[model samples]
Target chain A: MICEEMQERISELMDAELDDNESIPVHRHLSECQTCRSFFTSCQKMREAVQSIPYEDKRADYYETKKEWWRNYVRVPLPAAAVFILLFITGLIGTSMYLLQSDDPYVSGEHRIIYISEYPEIEIHLLTDRE
Target chain B: MDPSIIQKLRNGNEEARTEFYKQYRQQIYVYCYQLLGNRSDAEDTAQETFIKIFNGINSLQTAAAFRSWVYKIARNESFQLIRKKRPVALSHKLEYLEKDSVENLIESEDNARIVRNAIDTLKPEFREVILLREYHHLSYKEIADVMKTTTSAVKTKIFRARKSLLKKLSPYFGGI
Candidate 1:
């Protein structure tokens, strides 16, 4: 196969994804071609380098950290929700008390004399019990 | 993943949740670290992934599929962070390697840095496939499930991703 075609197959070949039928020709080509062989070899090396990189293992505290995370997950919203509910109740109570205590005619239980007509000869008064 | 642990997790057992976190944390963190290319980001992403997994555990239909399911969460979380950060550039020098250079590169710390940079240079899709397939040793089908793609598509992506990395690292590998 030409280099372009081999380029596509090279990865599959390295991954061992190719079946014997497909891999045999590619292996033959690599043996005969220096460029393809070099590229394939480099790809393998890169894979190995990636796989061998050293990384710190911080998983020792993962369980403890996860516990804290869960705690915060539950703790944060609960208090906030409670505060919100408490504020809502307080606001409702405050508004109800204000409405009950206010002297406004609409809400207050009081008697008032409303004048219907004020004329020189006639006068009429209506008593309203706003309770 | 044990079925009883999953059952306990579903039943809101905190100890089971902790055990689940302990079981998968390292692998998940390593997966994230490989994908994100930084310790801090990997840690944050892994933490978020676990939170998501626990929060959504009740939605899981089967315990046998927990590995795939958890990996799917990790991949999503890592992708989200990658999108948010969007590293500016991923560049590395390409130079020819001497004979027996692959062993030398594996032994040297600098080679590790080079590999990490090369991986970061890849597009997120390619990076995900490579990390899942190579570093995590996940099967093509498992990667497909995590990526929500076809197994054939995953294989194709892995091939393409390897090709891309090979091109980028040609300098280090003797200009191949």
Candidate 2:
């Protein structure tokens, strides 16, 4: 194969994506061609250099930055927050209205439980009416 | 990833998620840095990527490749940010970052500087394939999954990226 065709196989060989049988031809081509051999070497060197770019791990920085990002960007959206607030307000108003409407709250002399507007009956013989 | 950690993450355990953040933060940040070519943007994108990862942990299946899943979320988040910020302001940011990068290249050796320059000259798509294949050492299948492209496309991109780099470095290694 010409150098152009072998270059493709050389890439596969470099990546180890080729089987032994497939790589043999590319290897033979490299052995026979100086230009192709140099090309392969250059590719390998470039790959190594790119990978060798050091990755510094500042754990504290990463932690702080991640927390900051979450605080700044990952919070609830404005629309969602608005929806949540609306739901909360609706619930508050509902409970307030129910409590306000609690006129006959079954004020019993025996039971010590508080039921607001529920069980709307003045227990029997309780309060004595004082009328 | 251990099955227990995956389980914990799926259960929304913050510590387990933090563990994953510690493990992949550098890699994800480097990827975003190289792709976006800005430290500030890369940091923001990487952190948001983790948030998306934790938020979508349930999408990870037991049989799936965990790293691929992580990269897919990261890639999507990065692209979303890019789309959101696709204004003239972005080009200005990139130009400034390029200047910063150029200053650092002077401190590196000639060969390293040449390689960096060659890599930077590549289109972002090709550069990503090279970084994924060489730096990250991801399999073509995994890269395809992360990129949402076919393995054939990944292979083609890697080849073209190598070719581009070789042409750019021909001054030093001129046999090609």
Candidate 3:
């Protein structure tokens, strides 16, 4: 494998996670390349340093816990309010459109009744039936 | 439970919030400590990471992708801390120059502190890989999972990170 290819797999090799075939080339490279050997050594040192140091936080859990209260009480409410505002605006727009289009006399001109004249015979028959 | 806690949290369950914190708090803290190189900054950054998690976790969509989500937050917080010029507090930064500290820690001829301080000086990319490997003990696949990259990419970075660390620490190691 090329140096670049070998270098890329070296980390995995260090972790002993590389596949056997993949590890072979990197192993060969490290044996021959002084720079790669130093690189490998540094990786080991860095791992030790990280491992030895305690990862504990000195801060109390309660201090971190308090933010949850604020998240629940305040932060969550803000998004809800924003959604409410958007919905209210949409409702108003929809209502205005409905009112403007409706046949209601208040919003639109009055509906006029159309008078149609039937033939004289038909008109007489309708009067007779009504009588 | 399973990763479905993410769904419950999204639905506004309070218990899920506590569980979420309990689940990943230390891991994130460790990730932060590894990146920030100090306890105080790591603590602050870890808290900040959770806040982002709390606010944005609902939109994350994939419950299985939670690991990467947290790492992204940790990585961002780390770079932000570093950019803020907060000196990385190294427990071992000075031991190399002083003879006594070295003698005490190097009972068997180990350059442990030398490596630690050198790591602290690495650029964020290099430092991040080392931290993921060393501090988190993440396998290549898991590191790849968090990084949103291939396993090979993670490997290359770890190697490059190591190389950079060696170069940076060479003076302290008295020429590696």
Candidate 4:
């Protein structure tokens, strides 16, 4: 095997991302293993090379312009939200007014509520007719 | 991040928000620049990332998660731009070109440039996980959170990224 598991552990250990307890096995393995030792060395070199690329902060003014986009100039979602709330409130009022004033049988409650007992059983009425 | 800063952020304090921005701007810019391989795309992506993070600040649950959260936003934003502008990103690759040997140029500034080119050739998934670990100094667990994957997955991706970089660089200078 390539001491692969320990090599992975060594990567974390090199970065000090592992606590001492978790690092114990890695240390023990590195002490006894050469493959992982070389892996660790290469990882360090790689880190150095990658970190050497200095950060470039280009167009600070342009970046400033891009900032606070949500707070100031959200042209679409804000208007969409306002439209949503307005539609919701309008729908609520329309439904309420329809319930109160319209002549729709369901919404206006103008239809009479007939209890089941108010209707004579069709079977009984049919028997009476036959008799 | 300090808990007090998080609290200030929650309270929508402008100074705290600026503090948060200052803390991350360099890291975010560098990460975006390296990933997108261009200043314009990098700047646009970084700005969109900050906008997303600040706009979604309320959803962050803890102070400790802030670093990974910022990275997650940056990673997503960078990849989104890459997906939209694949040709632009693809043309930017300068990996493994015939150049001065890094071993000879070890003490020179060009070594960093060579290493950077090497990293650029990596496939984005491998490139990202390795950058998060090596360049960003994020822990395996933190990277897992940012990548939305298990730590084992992160370890595997990083290991593969290193091998991939080595394969590219070895052609020129016998590998790191």
Best by DockQ: 1
Q: Going through the candidates in order, what is chain B's TM-score?
A: 0.75, 0.84, 0.68, 0.82
Least accurate 10 contiguous residues by lDDT in model 1 chain B: B89-98
lDDT against the true structure, per candidate, is 0.75, 0.75, 0.68, 0.73
Q: Which sequence of candidate numbers ranks them by TM-score, best first?
A: 2, 4, 1, 3
| Residue B170 alpha-carbon offset, candidate 3, angstroms | 9.3
DockQ of every candidate structure? 0.33, 0.25, 0.20, 0.23
Clashing pairs in 2: none
> C-alpha displacement of B62 in model 3, angstroms?
2.4
lDDT of 2 by residue, B1-176 (tens): 78788887776666776677768878888777766666777777887888787667777775358988887777887788778778854786567557745445545566665566667767888888998899888888899999989988998899998888777666655646
Give one digit per residue, the lDDT tens place, for model 1 in B1-176: 78999988766677887788778878898888777667778888888888887778878987777888999999889888877766431321122223223444554558777776667667778988988878887777778888898988987888788878877677676675
Please, what are the lDDT tens digits per residue for candidate 1 over residues A91-130?
Answer: 9999999988988755664444444455545544434655
Candidates 1 and 2, the one with greater TM-score: 2
Write the residue-wise lDDT of candidate 3 on A38-115 in tens digits: 766755765666677655666747566475642633246346778999999999999989988876654554433343
Ranking by lDDT: 1, 2, 4, 3
Provide the lDDT at B138 for model 3.
72
Please give the TM-score that candidate 2 achieves against the real structure: 0.71
State the lDDT of candidate 3 residue by residue for B1-176, as single tens digits.
26778777676567888788788888888787776656877878877887777777667867766777678878887778777774433334444335443334444444555455455557767777787887777777768877778987887787777667656655543234
Model 2: per-residue lDDT, tens digit, A1-131?
Answer: 57878888888889888989999888888899997898889888778778766544454274755443443434453467789999999999998777766544443333244344766564433333322
Model 4 TM-score is 0.69
Candidate 4: residue B171 lDDT (0-100): 48
